[model samples]
Target: MKASVKKGLGTTIWLLSMIIILGGALAFALNPSPAKSIFGYRMYEVLSGSMTPALRTGELALVQITPPQDIAVGDIVTYAVSPDGTTVVTHRVVDKTTDSEGQTVFSTKGDAADTVDTNVPAAAVIGVVRGHIPIIGYIIGFVRANFIASLMLIIAAILVVLAVKNLSAGKKKKPANPS
Candidate 1:
């Protein structure tokens, strides 16, 4: 096979894999509805805007699911908006509140917002925001609002490209015609 064709195929495969993983992760992160979580998605909503100049309104955040003890006062955490509801809220920990039972609660806020949020019970937290990629959160939010179809498309594309590459590779190794 020509080196140029090999290079093109290699690049396409690499790109397809990256997009599938990254897009899937982003989609999963920003869309944490009760339905999604049961399916293994961990989602959080934007509040306060305190993290701004960073995170902003409507800019949902994604986090790796974890326990509350893993949270720190300075870390960003995502938790339920109401004790009775699954509506998730995301904010930065600015203070810690503990109950008489020795359970710890966390207080959080957004950098662009004006006030502190209600106390978040330890059990209320879903996970911490280890990092973010800015406005990209909104893109994930858009995909979520739209549905899971786009994500499935990207995943399908990745699989198809990978399969095609393998077949092409097999064909490239055949010997020239020998009469």
Candidate 2:
């Protein structure tokens, strides 16, 4: 291959490598699973504007699973809202009190709401918000919703890379004479 072509291909490969490395690192850092909490914080994607001002919809929130006794009235917590534990919500703890059975119950509310939500048992609480990243949650949600399309795009990218490699390899193999 000509020097100019080699230089162009080298630059393209370097750019692609950098993009892949950085994107993977960013995704891993912002969306860590329970088993991958290197920073001791769990990441959640905010799905509603209930916690607006402090945490907006489409944002990424980092939370830590502190003990129930450690939680204070003003803390923002992620908790399951349904009996089946499928529906989750994030709200500020308005009150903390023990029930008749001496079990701790939390009265939570959205920052934008005028009233507290239904009391949430301590066992239903997932974690307390430590911090948040603006707008990263939208990308994560989109990828999850359109997983098939994303997979197709990834496959297309791999095919393109393989085709380029084959073309370059073929260029390096030429007959001794054209005849």
For lDDT, the strongest prediction is 2
Residue 48 displacement (Å), model 1:
7.0
How many clashing pairs in candidate 1? 8
Instruction: Please list the residue runs of candidate 1 whose C-alpha ends up more than 4 Å from where it truly belongs after superposition.
Output: 1-50, 57-60, 83-85, 147-179
TM-score of each: 0.56, 0.66
lDDT over C-alpha atoms for residue 170 of model 1: 69
Write one digit per residue (lDDT tens) for candidate 1, span 99-136: 78898988888766688987788877877775555555
lDDT of 2 by residue, 24-142 (tens): 75567544243345366767779988888999999988888778999999999988777765567889999999999999999999998888898999999878999999988887777
Candidate 2 clashes: the total is 0
Q: Which residue pairs clash in candidate 1?
A: 49-110, 49-112, 49-113, 50-110, 50-111, 50-112, 51-110, 51-111
Which pairs clash inside model 2?
Answer: none
> For model 1, what is the alpha-carbon lDDT of residue 89?
72
State residue 3's C-alpha deviation in candidate 1, in Å: 12
